[model samples]
Every structure is written in structure tokens, then in C-alpha cells.
Target: MAEFTVNATRFDPYKNFKFRVKWDGKYVAGISKVTSLKRTTEVVKHRHGGDPSTSRKSPGRTEFEAVTLSRGVTHDVEFERWANKVWNYGSGLGAETSLKDFRKDIIIEVYNEAGQLAQAYKVFRCWVSEFESLPELDANANAVAIQTIKLENEGWERDYSVAEPTEPSFVEP
Candidate 1:
């Protein structure tokens, strides 16, 4: 397994951000999320095995294997035009005074045993908050910060498809 970091910047609110993951030179998974945080670290796990207990006839033994393609990390993230304007007030305006809500979407994809796209999952998070003595732009920064942390801390995983070989025919002479 191999690990890699994806940096997201110059975000576009209408467009979705995507990240492709490969293992052992094969497409393993992909992730897409709305651009928000300055950076996000993604950890992916790849493995194969089965449980004997689940089967009527145990295989006698069970095998477990896993590879960590990446570790905990933080990458730089940039916000889209609308999101940036909503968060930062670099134009010398006072901080945001009222609380606001922001929504972010994330997508995860994984392949099946036949080397085909098997599954995809979509998740979302919302941020809301109120601040005192806060400028209009900064009022929601705290909410966004909290939402970002929650998403990163959450563990993400997806299982690959299982393929079985067909039996061959035998002819007697």
C-alpha cells in the first residue's frame, strides 16, 4: 500500500473536489468533498481476508491482512469564492456579527473484486454558531472550524468486492 497527500485550493463552489487513491498500481478508491478547510488528511486501508466462523464449513483457519496507504496528516485547503467571502473579511471589514450555516458534502468510492466500481457513499456536515463581538465574516469561522475537525477525526473505510474463480471441466480419454 502507498500513501499520498492531496491539496485542495482555488475551490469552486459549483464543482465537486475529487481525490483518487491507488493501491499496488490499481485504482482502489476515490474521495470527493466540498472545498472548505485549509487542509484535510485522509487515511486509507487496503486488505483481503475472510472469517471462518461465518462459513458453515470453517476453512480451518482465518487470515487477516491490511495495509495503511497513508497516515494522519493535514493538507492545505482553499475555499470557493462564495465560501471564502463568507468566511474571511480581508477587505478590512469588521468581523462577522451574526451566525450562519454552511453545508459540506463528501463522497467515497471503492472498487469491487472484478476490478469494477462497487460502492460509493455520500456524507454531509453542517456548521452553525453565534458569536459575541464578532464581525460578520468571522462569526461563522468558529462553526466551520468545528465542522472541519469533526470530519477529519471521523474514521472512513470501505470494503472491496470478493471474486471467486469458476471450476474447470475435465475429460477422460
Candidate 2:
């Protein structure tokens, strides 16, 4: 495990645009957007018989929010293939779902301005819950065709192995 180090020179936070999503040890191509990672814990309230009105609260189950990834429609079928693993249409009655390898662990990496990997997260047991292969098309409208996939993951954790990077510096004479 890499020890955490603070980069005092880096005043500005990392830009959201410089990030990448990878699965199966390979980075997915052309991923334009990724929803924020979030988790919520259920609050459980309990009150004793003699206790006053207010109930004591405690944390219960925690759920990881679904993450949506969007990109311009292209020849790349990584999103479509993962979505199909959950439910494939026209693939016959008993063969609709690929149970053996449906879920995948994915990595989301954020890079600093100098293109150095600054942070990384490991999302576990993710399976596509929804997929949109193509947006509505119109001859009069001009826009890139976008596709999307919503992934439901069991949990995620920050990869502490990725230490803080040393920001690059330029010298001026």
C-alpha cells in the first residue's frame, strides 16, 4: 500500500474531464461522461420504553448508487456487450442472460493536469441495469449520436495504492 502524501503546491483541484473508465483490464474508448459516485446509508431509529420522544438513530444498510456512463455512438461495442450480458434480446428463451460472467469490477481513474494518475477507485460487482444504444435521430437536427449504460454496483472503494502525484513545474528564465 502506498502511503498518502500531500502535494502542497497543487492549489487547484483535478478537473473532472480528465478521467477514464476501465473494465476487464482495458480502458473503454470515447467515454464522454460518468455520473458521480455516491452511497447512502439507511437510518434506523430506536426508542426505549422510558425514553423521551426522540428516538436514537443508527446506521443501517448502505447502498451504492447506480452510475451512468455516456459516450458518442461509435463502432465500439463495449457498453453494448456488457449490457447484453445482463439481458440479450432475440437470443432464445433459456439463453437470455449470461449468468457466469455478467458482473464485472471496473476502475475509474482521475488524472491531474499533467496527465498523471492522481486518484483511482475500484467499483465491485457491477452489472448493467439499463442501456440505450442510440438516441432519437432527426434529419433536421445536428448532434452526435449518444449511447449510455447505467451500472448497478454492489460497492466501491478508493484505491489507496495510487499515491498523490507530484505536479509538474516549468522554469522561466
Candidate 3:
């Protein structure tokens, strides 16, 4: 993302002025009009939306609102892509850790198609060993661990099978 800085000054009609405005890009002289000095000053101040420390909500919210309102469709598409990527990754990882005595906090960093860090989500998986009723290192624990391994392996098989579908139904009958 490009860093945007705002530069504002009194519109001098007599003297030629040139300055780059935020988001609007480069602007040259005679582009902006200054009808009344007092009125223009009032309008500029109003546009600035008063002091930052004031109770009034910050202009950042306005900037976000403007961007979101303008790029609603883009935002939705980006969100869907992000969600799909996260789900695909999670599906792979979820099978591996399920029913095992793994850590509760698993952080997954999701990236956009442009390879930018979009967002992060936490995955919490339950373990049979963590349960009070299950005996430690007993048949039940071993069974659960075996189940987890099977699940993980099965997930990988499913992914590969989907990538190279050999079944008659998948051949488009």
C-alpha cells in the first residue's frame, strides 16, 4: 500500500500554487478556486473535521468508510479467496492434529493472492489425553492416537486423489 500524506494550505489566487493532494495526486495552480478568504478558511476547517483530540470520531473511520463503500465487490471477492485458502490449509492441518495431545493454540497466517499477509486465525483441537476420563498411555489413548494418524493420512490421500481423479464417476460419465 502507498503511504498517503495530506498537505493543505490557503488557496492563494494571486500567487500560483502547486501541491500534491492526498489520494487526488498532483495538482497545479488555478485548479482550485478561492472565492472568499473567510469562507474558504471556514470550508477548509470544516473539511478537516476539527481537532484530532476532540470527541468527534477520527477521520480514519471516514477514510475506511469511503474505501469500503467504493470497493464493496473487490472486498467481497478478496474475502472469499482468503476464506477458501484458509479453509484448504486448515483442512490439511486439522486431520493431522485431531484426537492427538496437541497444543490448543494453533496460529495460521493467511496470505492473499498477491502474497500479502491478509489475516490470521486460531485453530483449537481437542485431544483424548486431555480428557480426565481417558487413562494416560492406555488402550483408549493409543486408539485415539491411531485414529488421529489415520485421519491425517486420509486427508492427504483425499487431496491427492482429488488432484488426480482416477474413479469412473470423476471421469464425467
RMSD of 2: 1.2
| Candidate ordering by lDDT (highest first) | 2, 1, 3
lDDT of 1 by residue, 61-127 (tens): 2222211122122232222222343355564556542234344344444443334443443333322
Q: Model 1 reaches what TM-score against the true structure?
A: 0.25
lDDT of each: 0.31, 0.94, 0.23
- Per-model TM-score versus the true fold: 0.25, 0.95, 0.16
In candidate 1, stretches whose alpha carbon ends up further than 4 angstroms from where it belongs are 1-86, 89-101, 113-115, 126-173
* Clashes in predicted model 3: 0
lDDT by residue for model 3 (1-173), tens: 33433223313222222211111122211212211101111112233456565443323211100001011121123223322332333566555332333322223333333343333332233112211111235654433311110001001001111121121323566
TM-score of 3: 0.16
Return the top candidate by lDDT. 2
Question: Candidate 2: where is the Cα deviation over 4 Å?
Answer: none
The better candidate by TM-score, 2 or 3, is: 2
Which candidate number maximizes TM-score? 2
lDDT of 1: 0.31
- RMSD to true structure for each model, in Å: 19.6, 1.2, 26.8
